[model samples]
Target: MKEELSLVIAFDATSDAFAAEDVFRQNGLSGRLIPLPESISAGCGLAWRAESNLEKELTDALKSIDITSAHIYYLIL
Candidate 1:
């Protein structure tokens, strides 16, 4: 079976990650806040997980909140 893939958006700050979650919720994007996965080691302790195909929508939403420096990763989840 193929592994499912998802997008993980990590911020440099925990507050930013939480803020991004709020933005995603406000925009009606389906996602959740989770602990930063160990596979990726370059972000705050928190991350936002969402469908991989929603990159464009996520990017636009993050941009609206002036959060332009998040580390984005595509991972098998």
Candidate 2:
């Protein structure tokens, strides 16, 4: 799992996740909004998968766009 590092981002709600997806796409962020991974949790039901290294940039971008209710988790896939 150490070889597969990914950043899983969760939103407060489905709409928040979708809004983040739109912002990510508009800003050229490399990631995809997918159903929440079972390994993470069953709650929320949606998440964004991205490279661990891009976390800072993504976080800043999201914040600049006024994106709220996001939680980032670094994990090995």
Candidate 3:
């Protein structure tokens, strides 16, 4: 299988992560909650994974919820 680049959104707090999940789901965005990758040294042990192409949409959705501490990264997963 070919590796693909995905967008990882990490949060400083678990509540923020779950809150973001709700916002994403409500907006009909595509992504899921995942354990924070070992390579990443941030967040509350949970992260959100989504297609890189959804960065803009994700950002907009996040803004609606006042979520501004998310760290975004592009990596093969």
Candidate 4:
């Protein structure tokens, strides 16, 4: 299988991660909650994974949830 460059948003804490999940779910956004990639340990052990192009929208969603601090990374996985 081939991996593609993806957008992975790592939250600073579990609450932020869950909040993001909730916001995304309620808004019918794309992406899923995933274990933080081993290559990334910037924040909590949870991350949001989606197409790279979705970064802006995801960031906005996080903002809607009052998550102003998150680590955004582009990784191939």
Predicted structure with the largest TM-score when compared to the true one = 3
TM-score (C-alpha, index-matched) for candidate 3:
0.91
* Tens-digit lDDT string for candidate 3 (12-75): 8899999999999999999999999877874439999999999999989989999998999888
lDDT leader: 3
Better of 1 and 3 by lDDT: 3
Instruction: Give TM per candidate.
Output: 0.90, 0.83, 0.91, 0.88
Clashes in each model (backbone N, CA, C under 3 Å)?
0, 0, 0, 0
Question: Number of clashing pairs, model 3?
Answer: 0
Candidate 3 regions with alpha-carbon error over 4 angstroms? 42-44
Ranking by lDDT: 3, 1, 4, 2
Local error of candidate 4 at residue 19 (angstroms): 0.6
Stretches of model 2 off by over 4 angstroms after superposition: 1-3
> Counting only residues 3 or more apart in sequence or on different chains, how many pairs clash (N, Cα, C under 3 Å) in candidate 2?
0
Estimate every model's Cα lDDT from 0 to 1. 0.91, 0.84, 0.91, 0.86
Candidate 1 to truth, TM: 0.90
Q: Give lDDT tens digits, candidate 4, residues 1-77.
A: 88999899888888888899999888778888899988897443899998889877888888887899999999998
lDDT of 2 by residue, 1-77 (tens): 25788899988778878888888888899989878877778754889999889888888878976875688898776
Query: Can you tell me which runs of candidate 4 are displaced by over 4 Å?
Result: 42-44
Stretches of model 1 off by over 4 angstroms after superposition: 1-3, 42-44
Error of 4 at 52 (Å): 0.8
lDDT per residue for candidate 1 within 1-77, as digits (tens), equals 76789999988888898889999999999999888998998443998989999999999999999999998999998
